[model samples]
Target: MIEVDCPSPAKPRVSITYCTQCQWLLRAGWMAQELLSTFRDELGEVALIPGTGGIFVIQCGADTIWDRTRDGGFPDVKTLKQRVRDRLAPERDLGHIDRP
Candidate 1:
């Protein structure tokens, strides 16, 4: 008899890469917290990656959801939540955040 390993399906993961030199750890951590809180049941994990050269990027799986330089600076909490929700759970409602 041969033994085989089978892996279960994994939930979505979010990664926030921030610049260590720029002191963005707190900011990255806060964003991770927000995502976790909002998507408690939907997400697998939230990772904080340290980088330099003023990088602040938020990625969901293999897709880059937000790039500080490309998106023009940090996103407000509301916007960040919306973007994340869109990727993780498009049909889910964000209450006040969904209101214009």
Candidate 2:
């Protein structure tokens, strides 16, 4: 028998950067938990990065999924899930999130 090499797909890493001075750790942690719960299989890891100046940004791999400054304010859980789903698995349906 001959053997062939096969490589596994690289799962995307999610990074949530929140302002430390602004005291957004809970918010960041909540977001991270949401992502991990939703994309347990799709994501490689979810990281919370402490930042300052009231920054709150979510990134998938190297792509910025959500920027609080640019987008204007924080995103709701549904919106956040949709953004992450779109980036990692556009073809995957997010149940009720996809509706309405």
Candidate 3:
């Protein structure tokens, strides 16, 4: 029998890349803070990468969770939090976000 090792699911490392040319640091920082506070135990880390040309992207590993250009606008904190929670902890309920 060939034994194949599979890695267990660990806390996800989220990356939020925003445009430096557009001075989007404060916006990105707010998003990072929200994610950190909401997913304190579920996230490994949140990285803010500087870019140019009105770019803002959020990723979990190589998977793109949210993209500003693609999504059409900035994500609201509650919505963004739900996205992170869905990716990292699908079964974990986000109290207010999950509620109607």
**Which candidate wins on TM-score?**
1
lDDT of 1 by residue, 67-98 (tens): 99999999999999999898888999999989
Q: What would the per-residue lDDT of candidate 2 be over residues 22-48, giving only the tens digit for each residue?
A: 999999999999999999999888889
lDDT of 3 at 86: 79
- Return the clash pairs for model 2, or none: none
TM-score of 2: 0.88
Q: Which clashing pairs does model 1 show?
A: none
- Stretches of candidate 2 off by over 4 Å are 1-9
Residue 56 error, candidate 1, Å? 0.2
Scored by lDDT, model 3 comes in at: 0.87
For model 3, residues 1-100, the per-residue Cα lDDT tens digits are 9996443357678999999999999999999998989888988888899999889999988888899978889988888988888788889988878898
Cα TM-score of candidate 1: 0.89
Candidate 1: worst 10 consecutive residues by lDDT? 4-13
Model 1 CA RMSD to the hidden true structure, in angstroms: 5.0
Q: Cα lDDT for residue 97, model 1?
A: 88
Give every collision pair in model 3: none
